[model samples]
Target: MTRQLVAATKALLVLTLVCGVGYPGAVLLVAQLVPGRAAGQPVLVDGREVGSHLLGQPAGGPGWFQGRPSASDASGELSGGSNLGPSNPDLAAVVADRAASLRAANPDAAAAIPPDALTASASGLDPDISPAYALWQVPRIAKVRGLDESAVRRIVAAHVEDAPLGMLGQPRVNVLALNVALDARTAGEE
Candidate 1:
């Protein structure tokens, strides 16, 4: 009994140190090796930090291409979905409302409104939207920005990031990056 107890105690301490202390230290060291990512990939504009690429922002205005409907008010702090299942009346109502808004905003957009535009992502901090969603908003964004529709569409296309390694996820557009690029273009025109 004594021998078994001693062995168990030794194993616990050894495993705890290795798994808890050592593993975390190694991870921190590796993370430190990458500079911008280690520091949370801050998205900067005009040398001033606007937001992080990993998070979402409340991009409303006509000139901006909006991301998915964020349950967390587009801030990453309280990231989560609405928790309403598909059949929930409330969820349906919200989706309907959102679809109506999108239609009203982009009357020229003939494509069916993308699901990403009507529903919130599981992580309310989704900074990206489907390419279709981005394109759907191009007409409105161009009209608001006073730029040609094709030019704005090209901007959206340029910012469309492919799936990681060509297979993980669908191609999407980062709303923050796209808006930043739009701002830069507008500034250039000024």
Candidate 2:
């Protein structure tokens, strides 16, 4: 029994040091060396920090590019999903309301809306949206920004990221990055 206990204790200490200390240090070192991905990939504007690529934030104004639904609290530290099943009445109501608002805001868009625009993301903290979802809001965003719709659409197109290694995932646009670009362009124009 004593031999077994000593062996277990030694194994635990070694594993803990290796995983808890060495692994994290190596990861941090590598992250620091990467370009465009260091320090949490913070989104900045006019030399000021705005948000992060990993988190979603509310874009209340029409001129700003909106992110996916956030399941996080206002502070964005506690992340979670709505956990409402598809058949939940509350989920249906919320989706309906969001669809109505999108329609009202973009009367020129097609009546059929994208699912991403209406449905909450699993984590509710997704910072990206489908390229189609971003395009759907272009007309409304252009109108609010007093910019040409084509120009705004072009920016969205430029920001559209292809799937991982070409085909693993759908195209997505990081909302915070797009919005920051929008603000920078608008500021430059002014």
* Candidate 2, poorest ten consecutive residues by summed lDDT: 68-77
| Residue-level lDDT tens digits of model 2 in 1-190 | 9999999999999999999999998988888788567666787666888888877778868778777665564245667778889989999998888888888878877647888888777777788999988988888888888899898998899999999999998999999889888887788779
Worst 10 contiguous positions by lDDT, candidate 1 = 70-79
Leading candidate by lDDT: 1
At residue 133, candidate 2 shows an lDDT of: 89
Give the Cα error of residue 165 in candidate 2, in Å. 0.9
Clashes of 2: 2
Question: Local error of candidate 1 at 22, Å?
Answer: 3.3
Question: What would the TM-scores of all predictions be?
Answer: 0.87, 0.83
Model 2 residue 34 distance off true place after TM-score fit, in angstroms: 2.5
Off by over 4 Å in 2: 1-16, 33-38, 73-75
Instruction: Compose the digit string of candidate 1's lDDT tens values, residues 1-190.
Output: 9999999999999999999999999989999999789888999887999988888888858889888898889666788999999989999999999999989988989989999999998989888999999998888888888999888989998999999999999998999999999999888888
Candidate 1 contains a number of clashing pairs equal to: 0
